[model samples]
Target: MRFMFKTDYEDDIKLFPHSGYLWSYGSLLLVLMIAPFVLSSYLMSQLVFVCIYATVGVGLMILTGFTGQASLGHAAFLAIGAYTTAYLQQFGVPFIVYFLAAGVLTGIIGAMVGFPALRLQGIYLVIATISFAFIVEEILARWESVTHGNEGMRVKTIQILGTAVPRDSPAFYYLCLGVLILTIIGSLNLLRSPTGRAFVAIRDSETAARSMGINVSLYKVKSFAISAAIAGFAGCLFAHKLSFISPEMFTLQLSIEFIIVIIIGGAFSLHGAVLGAIFVVMVDPFLTFLKDDIPGVIGGLAATLGAGAQKASHIQDSVAAFASANGLKGAIYGIIIILFVLFEPLGLYGRWLKIKLFFQLFPLYKRATFKRQKIYVKSERNR
Candidate 1:
């Protein structure tokens, strides 16, 4: 393992951190830059989705991860953004202008949501956000004149400057990839700023943060707006990807999926957002493989064990039916969340850190270094 000894405080704050970082990130960037050509069309489309979801994850990460706020209504902000873009595009607006409008409009609404959040925390905040989402959904459904009710509104082709970018085109993928990169960069900078520190301070202890002269309420509101704006920007892309906008698309399930993205990815780290996005998107194919292969494998085992061919065939049919059912996907997603929460709470990023440290400290690595510290709450009388 190689180490970079820092010479000064400035060295610690450098964007690259060390030469190693520059090389690693530079190589990753090179890979992404050529991915459209090197990867298949379906894979490129999934990468675009990963980029979009990662941006949304970063937005949610800002609130839940950094600011310590609970939100179950981000899907509302996403809907606002998509509808804003869709509605504006109808008037022949430029992509740059409408994109900004989606973010700005969603930001303003997010601030409104934040106002109510100041008086709430924990589960209450979660419930409030859920209510907010429901309210937004009901309004979208009832406002038939504008939202087209349940019939859904079609999103036009993305036009940057005068060039039309179809969802399937490489240009569209680049557009999303570029947006994700900008979101990550901006988030990193924000976390390094005083305002970002104030967010963390509020998250740790609002009373102590207030005593330290930080405007707790203002920063919480700011965090909400920032997170919402990012989600809104992601929604703009989500709209084009579907080429259709409907209230049903941005449901509570979508909001929960966003939360899952950050959680299973590593809720506390910026890198977790991307990792989680990749996991959430890629897991579908993995599940699809399992759906196809599990039954055959089990049946083959039964046949080898001297079971009749009819019995093996029956077992295979039953397993295949169970695996291929529509509800099975949601069940599997739930199971994954439970497993991750119980066994690997620190998430994919946390797992990667352990692997990295194992190599970095080969022959000296201890499992206890990453073990969760068990704490028991003591009664006041015992204390």
Candidate 2:
């Protein structure tokens, strides 16, 4: 029986040549490197934008995603990082040191913010965090000397480790990519360790976890601090990348966008965060192209809007306005959360697992059968 089972497993392994782990890592690396070379300037900008979002998404994954703490004011943390970097840079601090300082400072702030978690849970915690974010923004706006108010602060080319690097240079891309890779690795390692598992256990049930000897409060506060630190690191990277910082950029809307990313990508899973970033980043351009190029080819069908066609030519513009104005991303994100809550709470990663399982177990697999149920159960229990 052992020999038969071994032979069957070998056959299965041969059928699936690439391990999921290898495929995920290799694919991500290849895309990150090749994207700069293959993509146009317009696209490179979008890709850079995606990396920025991914950086924050990773942070959120650690907090709301992994530790089950919800924050709608995450952009506030990013604001803290961005402004801290800008202010420090103005005083002629070394860029790397300033960025590190931003992370540490924000980590401290995050811990303080996590104090509310002692009493609040569920949506109440969300409200507390969101309120904290707004309060911070108000301080930044009113404290003109520091945040520079609505005019914001400008950063020159960052001098890191004794080398000056321009924001838009290819070197910047490499730098952001390196930071992203390291952060992801750090997060993954943390998730696999005892402390990380303790966070997950606490997220699942603070009462139960505490009963089992886990320090629930410690983990909760630590998770917030760690998450905020990551957000701050990403914010500093954004400051350098854009070289222009503004209070307007870190509004509640931006916080909603961060949430959208994890919701669309998959909360509690690193891959989901990455994928969510990609989806949000790419969707605009994809639709823009459709609005412009598609209308040229397919606009003949909607010829009645001929005179008005030029004004409404780009579906992307109108859709984007609607999305931004009515919080389309937020609405979509909420719907996604609802759907996940109703049927597929694991998000895109869960859906991808289902697809992979179907393919791997094909031929013998029946239609509409849930092959990835165990993964969902485990992941949800961890959350």
Candidate 3:
């Protein structure tokens, strides 16, 4: 195994600690830069969505992962961004301006929502965030003059320097890729700063952070603003990608999916957010494939059991019906959360670390390498 020896204080904040990260990520970026030219149209689209979701995931990771703030109303911020894009696009403003306008507006709203909720913790904080989402959803629906209510607003193609950027074109893909890169860079820098350390300290224990002179409430609000701003950035691209915006698109379900993205990707790690976004962006399509194949398998099994053609058809239809329910997908998500919490709380990125460590240690590897450390509090008596 390669050992990294720290020589100076600057090494602690180096973006790439060693040559390994630099090379690996450099190669990855090279591959992605060339991907649009070689990949199929469908694959290109999937990659675009992955970038968008990953951007949102990183923002959430900053709050929920690094900062230990739990929020379930990111969908509201997303809606704000999308609708802002939809409304602003009509005036033919520069893409950068409206894109930023969305994030700023949403961030301000998030700060407002987060301010009062600072006194709450755990599930109560979650409820406060979700409640904010509910209010946003209601506003989007009732404000028909602006959002067009259930009718949904149409989004225009993105334009840059007088050129239209089609969603499927390489330029569009590169745009999304560039945004993702910038988002990751900004988030990394934030995590390296004193504010970032404050976030981690708050996450570890708000009480301790307060004792250390960290303004916990102010920082928490800042965290929400930053997280919501990131989600808003994702919304701008998501709006253009779909070519439409509707309140329904930014429901509680979508917020839940964001949570699922970070959880399955791995909490407290930026890599987990990216990995989770990839998994989430691909899940519906995977289910679609399964939906087409499962009924046939059910029918074949019934036939092999000597069931009549009518009986086989009945069994197949029943299976198809069950699979068709949207609730089934939600239930599947619930089960996935349960399983991940119980069996792999660290998530997909955590599993990758374990595998890497196993290969590195080989004969000397033990399960305890990844075991959770016990938390202890100190007092006059304990000390």
Candidate 4:
């Protein structure tokens, strides 16, 4: 159990609420700084992926979680960033210039999309975003001169201060970590500002927020711009990491994966983005391993069950065919989304909060402490 005693108004809104947070976060920073020295190269690469995805997840959380405006087309922003960066690099643009340009361009585009989308709500907004994603994907595929169409385009190595940073080097990993830290700090600061409060107010009740004199439309568009900018920044890092990108890489499925990150991590919390990114990136390798090994496992199990050689061979072939199907991964993702929505809507962060509360309360903790209430509303009855 940790206790924080507030001394003044400043304490109430401090980024780190307690000494415990300072020490914990400081330790985490230390660990991240030294991680590359101890972790394998492959693991370090995955960490880069986590940081990039976490950036996108945090952006999406700002829109859907804080602003109550959901976007299913963030992958389009990411694609814009990657393609823009790649194109500019070919023209001998500096890394920083193109990176910032990519983000700015995406922000402008996002604002344009959000402006027209202000009248949309609920499922209509979702459908519109989905349509936007498809449109972007088609443009990327057909714009052969700029994007190279389906042939894809290679990204230049990240260069900083006259040094080309190798993708697998510790310097690249540290670069990613540095950018991630800056993003987190920016997000935390933004959330502490009055604008953040307005966003939350809008989220809770748009009519109430408008009545309170908040410019709901402007704020919604601002939220989209900021979110898209962050995603574009992440996409810049992503292109450099992969060294190549295609229209297929930024599909609707990629956007859905970003949504899953926040949904499973805890939509309402910034830390949830990092936790979700780690979970998704870490689990991905295991899924790949399973895809490679499941057929062998099935064959061995069939042999143990005293099946004939031909039968065992047929079973292994069938299992391999199933394992290799691309849709299998999609099915797994869908099932996971369904399970999390049904059983843990608040997600892993919410679960962690519960565990911490239980420990704090100890013997005073009751099973009903956070039980869900089955409230029957008169409005529902009337409907």
TM-score of each: 0.94, 0.82, 0.95, 0.93
Which prediction has more favorable lDDT, 1 or 4?
A: 1
Each model's total of backbone clashes: 0, 1, 1, 0
Task: Mark the regions of model 2 whose C-alpha exceeds 4 Å error after superposition.
Answer: 1-20, 286-299, 304-343, 366-383
Error of 2 at 107 (Å): 0.5
Q: Candidate 4: where are CA atoms >4 Å away?
A: 305-313, 367-383
| Highest TM-score model number | 3
Candidate 2 local lDDT, residue 334: 69
How well is each residue in 46-144 modelled by candidate 4, as lDDT tens digits?
A: 999999999999999999999999889999999999999999999999999999998999999999999989999988999999999999999999999
Per-residue error for 110 in candidate 2, Å, reads 0.3
For model 4 the TM-score comes to 0.93
What local distance difference test score does each model get? 0.91, 0.80, 0.91, 0.90
Tens digits of lDDT, candidate 1, 1-383: 87689888777667677678788988999999999888999999899999999999999999999999999999999999999998998899998889999999999999999998899998999999999999999988999988888888999999876889999999999899999999999998899889989999887767668779999999999999999999999999999988998899889988988999999999889899999999999978888888999999999999999898999999999998988888786897899999999988989999999999999899999988988665433332242
lDDT of 2: 0.80
lDDT at position 35, candidate 4:
97
The clash number for model 4 is 0
- How many times do residue backbones clash in model 2? 1
- Two-way TM-score contest, 1 vs 4, winner: 1
